[model samples]
Target: MFENLKILRRAVKAVATKDPELRVQRFYLIQEPQVEFLDRSTHYMNVGFWDGDATTLDTAGEALARKLGEAAELRAGDTVLDAGFGYGDQDFLWLREREVGRITGLNITPHHVEAARARAEAEGVTDRLDFQLGSALSTSFEPESFDRVVALESAFHFHPRSAFFREAYRVLRPGGVLAVADIIPIDGATPRMAFKAGPLSFLKFSLPDENWHDGSTYAKELTEAGFADVTVESIREKVYEPWRQYMAGRVDDDEYRRKLGKALHKGVVRHWSGQDVMRQELDLLDYVIAVARKPE
Candidate 1:
């Protein structure tokens, strides 16, 4: 009962602390004039996760969604799992568009859970999908389940990616495939440095994850985790180049983007030196995808 009460309090606090308008402004992706997330004055957020109370998404959020879906090889009737479910937009959107049968979504954030639930109900996929408040390191589901599991753009926020890989492998049935997608570092990402900037900041300041390395080393980890047919392939078409273009496309010209980028960098430096340090650095894993299969 005490645990349940604590859970309820956290949920209530998550919803009550910020107004919906503020959330939509910084994190929601509906940017048309008629929609809530359209205003341009909002501070930068990476595709809707709040960083320093800011609300914003890259201009290529929609395009990136399509690319992510394609990379996951989504198909109809696939029993899927979405790890690190964000606002639930990508999973919800992909499942519905692809007519996937059953999808279970898990994330650490209460705000993400609530939003994902609301959006699923709104989209009328609530019956086919289930949203749970959980973590990638440990999920609340039976083992040897799910046809495909995707950790799109959210895996790097998980520490020791090996744990998640093990969990994913455990929950996947023979012949089931697991795909991990996220902004990974090519190299030079120490546990300490990982604690500093980019997506890791969200985990450190607000959530979990203090050790996030790029998937370059994850292939060995996955192999050691007992998965077969393990391959760490780069989906360059879907990740960095597109992301750079998408975020860059929001402004009118190069000059405007440069100005905004500098301003955003200045704010990061003021609030988070870790993020400030990464302002112009490009990572080989600015976008990457890894696919492995549980032995059939």
Candidate 2:
């Protein structure tokens, strides 16, 4: 098919490029050609939370958002700092479901920021939402400006994730909560296991420079960043297994093949899909929900 050929060519081109930013951009672009197949309302990119209650992708994604929100103890009047706010999906959920007062989102991706801003305007929540082109490590916001800080399934992409913790601590008000739904390499996981998982896992998701760490490392970093009562809970079974099952079920679907071709073209779908690698090597990774608070 023409789509498959296009995807093949894109994959070759992506492989030839060495720029990390460009590679990331290419990976996101994979969604452009497959938007119709995705749940556009949520625009979710993380592993869904399947707690036996969620029978559909939208509800699973909402479950994950709710879990993060509860972990952060989000209050109706709270001002939130959403780091890596992917397409503003979770932000919209918080605004609608939690009635959060305002959210200032930081994202490195320009197009995502633009889309989020447009979505907010369309939903008449523009006054309550601000999406900016920025990284979690560096931001222009004043110290202690936000009541809560959250990074949903995105902290893993932050190179040296500790830096983001420090920045989050700096930006959060005293007594503010910091919550992250993140992917961590299991303790003692080695490069060999990552390599064996294939190109998407090793090159795209677990880049050497990213310095992905385990739960303990993350907890230590949070404490060092001046957070108190830090907790890191591994919920891989609730996240990975069901998400894998859902995705695997869709793998052979007609719509999924079309999307897979786009992912392939972007060089984002390597030898192994996420579900395949996770099922085969469960010990190499863990999904975690981490929460901490700044002292009042």
The TM-scores, one per candidate, come to: 0.66, 0.86
Clashing pairs in 2: 7-265
- Candidate 2, residues 1-296, lDDT tens digits: the string is 46546655756665566765566555565435244335335677777798878866778888999999999998898999999888879999899889999999998878889989999889899889999888888888899999999999777767668889999999999999999998777863555334454423433443435445678887888999999999999988887667666655665567656645664433434343665555766556788999999999
After superposing candidate 1 on the true structure, give the runs of residues whose Cα lies further than 4 Å from its correct spot: 1-59, 189-214, 236-238, 241-280, 283-285
Residue pairs with colliding backbones in model 1 are: 26-55, 26-56
- For candidate 1, write residues 1-296 as lDDT tens digits: 34334433543444343443232223222221222233343222234322233223543454445555665677898888888767666776677678888889987666667877987798787888889987778876799888888886666656556788889988888888888765555553534334444433333323223334555567778888888887776555444444443344444445544644554434323433433344444443345667787888
lDDT of 1: 0.59
lDDT, model 2: 0.77
CA error at residue 275 for candidate 2, angstroms = 6.9
Model 2 TM-score, 2 decimals: 0.86
